[model samples]
Target: MSDSQLISDFFSRDVLLGDRALKAAVADRGEEALRLFIPEQEGYGASGLQIEQRLAKLAASIGANAVDYLIRVIRNGSWQSMLSAAPAFAGLREHKQRATEGLVDVLKQGEIDSQRLAIEALGYLGADDLAFCISEFAENGEWIPQRDHRRQPSRYHLDKFYFYVAQALIRMTASLTSVNAISRCLRQFRDFLPICDEVLGQNRISGWDVRFVQHNFPSRAADPLVRDWIASDSHFLQDCGVEALGHLRLSRTSAFLLSVLEDPRFNDSVRKTAGISLSEFADAGAAAKLAERLNSASDSPGFSWAFASLYAHDVAWPACDEFVEELLGQENNDSEISAHMIYSLACRGDTRAERSFSALNSQHLHMRGTGAIACARFNPESAREALFGRDEEANNPMELACILAAQVHAGHVEKVDSLHQALTTFGELPFLRPIWKREVLYAFFVAEGSDSERGRLWCEAALETPRRVVTEMQALLKRRAREVSANRLPRSQAELASAASRESQEVKDKFDVFISHASEDKINLAEPLYHALVAAGVTVWFDKTELKLGDGLRRKIDEGLARCRYGIVILSPSFLAKQWPQNELGALMARETVSGVKAILPIWHDLSVEELLRQAPMLADRLACRSSEEMSSIVAKILDVLKD
Candidate 1:
């Protein structure tokens, strides 16, 4: 058949040989066959979803083998084709050098949508050198507001090219600190702030990007500008300032934030935000001042004092007790404040608050819950008694959850079991509030013991719970598991080094280490460690380093795992929840069992020994290190382990 006939036959649903014909066409005609599906034309006769899926599958099949053809599709095909081809290009790790060159070409020449796809692909491929390329596009790109003739105020839209480019840069820099790529890009686009502000005022930008700036770019040169925004009449600007100040934690701004809090002239939102920001400061004076304000104020200004008290506790200010006492003395009888005071006292292990155990029967259910929690810390028996005596029929889920949490704290395993039975029995009742279900799940999570086999059984049950409950329970379990791991004795230096040597001798591998981590942790903890390992002359097989354009991601990762002498499992909340990392860890464990050699190195990040035990009991006894230690020190220690 002629090429046209072949193309026609391939897209024809009636043709049994369509898949075969298309494969042959792609192999023979390359770009020509791919281009047919590029535009929204009659010849390319598939629904949008069908077209996208078909194109994605075809691109994956061709992969690195047809890098040139894929590049042509990106360069010459219609917008639709470019979008479909971008993922293929990103996945082509074997041909990364060529694929990146092609993507950069498309980035320079393609339309806004095409540019966005290219930018995203490049980011996925870890092309950090192209940071300038992305920043340049963002700087030069125009704002194209969507036009609507029917509407009076036309909705504003940024050139999505610039927006995606900024997004991509943030992703790339998230895991890396040496580059400071995000700050650099922000500086380059500093002149565009007015335009950005205008667009932001119209709510054109996503809340994610705004939060990203407030979180990641704090203490930058632009912070002064952000501070100026606090004084602006615009609520958006004020919100941004409050968020930035909280993250920045600049002690210099404590006085200003306190002023904002004390000034009744300001709106409640801004004043409340200032109160939150003031808590971020480690200054004891700030905490004292806030306590004084709480004491003198006629009415409770929402939960500002509660926030301030919590912050004081977090910083471990010596004056926290004084602040808590001041708050307790206040005539304001807000349940929220009372609960917070009880919680603060509980966290501090202060038995002086035992006098307030009677509040466990308070009319306010939340206060009762808080009181139970406080009682559990100082007197577990009292807490258990208080909880058991409560009228079960009248109690809400929050109250029940608090009671169960207190039971967990008191180590009343039998009571916890009874509560779980009650929750499971009536959990799905139509009349029960959704919050009750969530609280029950949380109670189970907190109550479960790290060392207990029953805890594992409960977690398995929690997994089978409702979607929301399951998600919350899983997170809680993971967090508790990390805590367990953290409290355990870490492996000794000599032992770690000995294990690394033995694994190296056994595997005879090309790479010294394989980093298995969750994508969510890539920016904050995983990538930095990956880079640090590489810098320390460790032949690390990290995804960002080893995976190139047009390569099969899973296949490459598997190969790295097989060839590497040792594997580093960076355990975090994100890592525990991700299936891929868990799968990789499972494989690593299998290898260790098969070879009868120690191979996996667990690196704890914000987790405990109990939390680790909940997930991997086998690993609980094994020596591990923490991400909280100095990065360089951690690297040096790992290198010691790697060295023969």
Candidate 2:
């Protein structure tokens, strides 16, 4: 298409039309088409801002040819577009000198909005040479008291122009020489604290902006200000204050932090933050005080136990044994709570709680896992016996995984062969719990420490396993592998063989399969399919079973995609309508481009291939099994695909 036609198409009101137009502009005309589309003045609304953002991204992608265009946008485009284009100018290495000069000129002569954009652009561009000029603007910039034309009226004392200047100075502080100038401006602005406080009081300013102000202040000046903030009525400020105090580690404020922790009226979150700050103190008294709080708040042990754990790690807490024992003896406490108490007691070399370990095996499934882990820690023989005993009878995969983990953690090298056999047998089953797969994998990786061939094989298998394991265990395995690799080198053929085995495992993906489906399809199709795959010994990421509370859904899903060998996207009308499933599919497709793997295994669910093509054409191209088929036949097909 011609540049003007592409530009018109790119700016079309329809989302899809705009996307297609932009693609054509970039693919065919490249930088020339992007330049033609840049808005010349401050008139385009939200849609215009989005288009400019896209243009900025495209301009950055084209490198130097788009630098002049981006500079022009900074000098003439709408305020929002100028802000959007500022970072693009920062990425131009070859034309930075010219871009810098242009931005400086805009700062000096452009309208207020343009000047603000220029200041921020200079910061991002790392124009440290203009730190003095920027500092001058920050200190003496006019505080226009006019209402914001686009948004609600305000009582903000400093205008948008000065706010951007302060923001720029904050960014500039990363350069050593800019620190003094920024600090001076910060002190000067301290005079406007009441106005800033009023702005904060009225909830007009972002907590992030307020934190920026707090973070830039010199510690000597910040100490008292943060101390005052801790006392402020605003819980956000109080939380920030506590966090700042923790980072500063000012010995003098230990008493103040202790006071915050002691205050019953303070929000639990603020108290929790204060407790974290207290944990940083070197004083043994901090541990004692934390213990006192743990004792007082028997009803709410989560934060108190967290603080106590931190304190126990930092200082010698001889008193914690009694606290832990008392807490453990209580029947009302759950297995997790009891486990923490046991762990704390064990940390102090107090094995008096070992008697309670047997009871954990009978508690909730999760508690039983924790108990198994503790058993491995406190008593290895018991852990090994438990694993052997539960190998055949344990129905819950997580519980079995935990027992296996205990066996590995206890260094049961002789049992590795048997464990591997058990794993193989378990994999052939029709329904394995997703958590069990992770736990078993984790145990195998952990137990791979032996120099035996079986140990090497287990390690190799773990290294080959894809992202089916939980993030924590994955990180631990990576760290352990690095430690193992760094500690020694192979000096013989046998050693070389061992090293080669581990090396060979790295080529394989961690997970055998990832089950992707809509939550609505859980009971009818997804659940049955997931169980079938697991029973057949495939590692799968099924959301119904894998996702835990407190996980960021998108982040967890991304991790699953990165680790899985194949994605089973169950295509249904409901699945197509949901944003998350589509997002997951998009991520899987992106991964395919990088990994050169045909990763998706689509399953048709009450939908025809034509219907699927209407929603996801690329996915429709893949061979798929129908949900209407016999469950066992479908499972067999999925197993066959995984086996290959």
Candidate 3:
């Protein structure tokens, strides 16, 4: 059949999972094929592909040839079609008359998704002239859906249109750091601080995803509204503000959250959550302030105790060694809290950390088994022995799980193995207490990665574990994985490589592992790894075989790199020396935020952790499989993310 007929069929049919169907119809056409389709109720709403990746790839695929075709779809008034084709303008540097006009019409006449499309496209295409039209639509407030009062005030969720408009504005003026840009910031930070005074202001907060009123909000007018959602009992409402605060990391919030960290009015959960939030913005200034607070805070044990709940290694621990020692001597003697303090201090070269842990774990302090657990994070060599010695005693099962988590943080493979064997049900324990899953156990999967041996066990036990915990893990995994792309491939090279392949449409397709190796290791570890992956029923992308290399060899390899969710590198000496493989690894590392945060799983063949860290610091933090392990055991570890 002809291409026109195929495109017509795609849009006319109420196709679900259209990716597979489209791949069959025009395997060669790439994302350009999706645009050629005319209209259908829905074709590609939900698929295996992430919404952002799929949207981005489509925009990237639209060419001058498809501009007219896309315009036709926008005019066709299919919101689904408009969503796909509207982004065409984003890909092209040049504006087309017919297409630009059609999107404008959609903005004026269309409903939610359609209007959202026009707004985003205009913003992305940098349509300054039409910015007024989009702004007018937003200000008119016609899109706000009327709803009942059942959903509490300040807890109402708006459609994604508002976020799209805000994002569009950010994209359009991104080049300018002028006063106008600051003016356009629209009280994002203005209302951020008042929450310190209100402290979950009950009668005050009115709304968010709000009318946003105008381009300019009176600084404190937005205060109660911002404070309301931020302090909401609902996670969804709070996250809307929290995510924005974290991403913007405005200097305003650093002080605000720090104040929230110290305020006695807030409960432990709020204070600790604030501490974690403040930890994200931890700087020398913030650290110094926290330290000063620590020094002066002779009696505010709550301030110091909650601050130690998480020991992010990057935090520059305060020079308050005396303060920490003094706090330890007082009634601030919770074992778990003390353990986190010990681990964090030790990481920053505090000499008293080992001594602190020893006392905390001993009968003299009588702190529970928890101190050994948190201590393991910094010094697994010592924590592992203490953990094992208590195994014969009636130790807390949950507390032992905490120790294993500490070992996961330390990331010594031998020690990790020793600790896991001691715990036995390493994956199942932390999950039993759902609260700990967020507070304490997110470290378990983040550090080990959701594809490690422990992750595999976690996934297996997920069937028996509470659904909320499983859902939390999945969400956390995605959030941790998503970061800003620092992709190493220059645009020109990316254009000619796996990016431009026919498999560009295969955004949803994922293999278990792409065996990235230096060709030199095909004999020693690479070949065996490939066969082992295949034997374990893994969807291995070995590029078939080394000898089968052909003209499309680079393209095929690139496709494997792009398509695979995990890139298990055979990081041997030979692999480290090769420039192409290094670039491949760099590309994978860049996509860690864009694709999977823990995408690169290294196979340290004849490479020490120190050597790996020196050569590729990015991969060193990821839990790696060793080439020295038995092939079966290695593949079992590799399948951790997939097996469940």
Candidate 4:
């Protein structure tokens, strides 16, 4: 009956009757329910009609995901309410052209959330006309000003605003023919970089969300501005600026980053960020300098982070013997940083570290845990000793399960019994057991044993574990079954044959063509090629359309490559220019070399023959076509090869 009552009902989880009634009322009565409760929010002074209009605006926004409600409100609400709710309407692409005036009014208000939503809606609808509006906002206006403490935006409003900004940025980037529009917005916020840097230095944001500033940084944001940021008195700004620059992969920023790394004034996190930035910039000298900094025992933590960066990007950051000895000798160090040190040293697969890990019979649970994980990569025997619960003293079920999985990975038959026992004993701990349980069991089967009894038990247990855990269990069990029949470890000849057999079966099951294309050129060629193929009596597996469920995209692509009659790639100007496309082409070329399966059929779109020949000489030598009709013709050739 009132807003207070409604708010109270919203929060009261236990009041089932009231919650049900409120939800039902919202569903059934819609605007009528709000009119009746007008006194609650705005008091007796607010008229019923005005209350209805306001409630409709709030409803349209807050429950914007309810497409039906959004459509109804956009079509029926007053012009002002419709305008305020236009973004939600545009998301559904259900608004009439008349609603554009209403949307403009809301856009003019320059409320960050509204503007973001409007921009997002425009993008969702692919309304090219909104380009001018987005540019105007980027140039002349600001994101809704950060809310003051007393006048803070609601959480819903803030979330909506952030979501809109992310979507808008993506859309605006798409709208620009060149990087100029994106560059302009970034330059406008160039003044904020120091503030961003300062915030980062203070660790104002967590590592995961640091990408917010990083993603928004312009390609040219790495100018002398970064040097100014590092030299500034504000440590916070300098830290964040370095991290942002690293993420932007600005090689030009590496010299400046290296200089900062040499300075003792910069904190460990700042130095680490700079080191990683240097690696990204591909400054081999910077990597060597960072490695040199790791020469001392005290520099271990900084070195570990830098080492991780270098390792990821395939950079040559040598691990010094002194550092390796210091790390192996660090049994008494109790900080979480010690775990990082252990991980780094273990990553090197130094026989000394391996020996030290094996020799450690009674290490701290945490150290053993880290060592177990690290040793899994190389010496699974040491990993098992440090991790498996084979002895009564090695009774960390969590560590045991993990190490057992590692042992299985290393194909250590000796550790199979220990892995089985650990899984049975520790599989009840949701945090520890659920994930590694299946992996350890898979390893058990891989260790040359027919534990049909254990396999049956796990199969039953898998059905009851959470859905997230079940799929992994099923995959592991099926793999184990094939392994058992074939009588070989995962890496053995028999296992390889089984894998080939399974892959060949899957290929026969799908029997569709895999079309690979760069996302940027999706609109111009990839999208049409997929449609034309589907229209031309070919089953199509276009990633954007068929790979709608997000997880395992790369795996799906690989599977398709193995199974498909052919792989049709649209090679355009932007496609060849991008690293990801190059990677796909390289993979296809590698596959062809090994299998002699001419699966990849290239289609050249708008590229000169010479340009194609020069950029991708190997691909240019293959059968390719220039148009959709030509693409269809090439498909017949592919079918002929598959048939043969």
How large is the C-alpha RMSD of every model relative to the true structure?
17.0, 26.5, 20.1, 14.5
lDDT (0 to 1) per candidate: 0.54, 0.54, 0.47, 0.47
lDDT of 2 at 600: 79
What's model 1's lDDT at 115? Answer: 66
Segments in model 3 whose C-alpha atoms lie over 4 Å from true places: 1-41, 46-50, 61-102, 111-113, 120-135, 139-179, 185-276, 282-285, 293-343, 349-376, 382-644
Candidate 1, residue 491: Cα displacement in angstroms equals 28
Instruction: Output the TM-score of candidate 1.
Output: 0.38
Shift of residue 108 alpha carbon in model 1, Å: 4.6
Position 368, candidate 1: lDDT: 77
Which stretches of candidate 1 lie above 4 Å from their native place? 1-166, 179-182, 188-192, 199-203, 206-208, 212-307, 310-338, 350-375, 385-407, 412-644
Residues 181-235 of candidate 4 have per-residue lDDT tens digits of: 4444333223433332342333323343434324434333443234344455656
The 10-residue segment with the lowest total lDDT in model 3: 213-222
lDDT of 1 by residue, 272-366 (tens): 66665554343343444455555443233433443423432323244345655656654246665566566555444456567448777677775
User: Runs in model 4 with CA error above 4 Å?
Assistant: 1-106, 109-179, 192-209, 212-238, 244-260, 263-269, 276-301, 308-319, 327-341, 355-369, 382-408, 411-644
Backbone clashes for every candidate come to 28, 12, 3, 7
Cα lDDT of model 2 overall?
0.54
Question: lDDT for model 3, on a 0 to 1 scale?
Answer: 0.47
Which digits, one per residue and each the tens of the lDDT, describe model 3 over residues 109-223? 6665666767766654545444433443453434232322122112111223445655454344422223223224322222322331143344232224321212122112122
Better of 1 and 3 by lDDT: 1
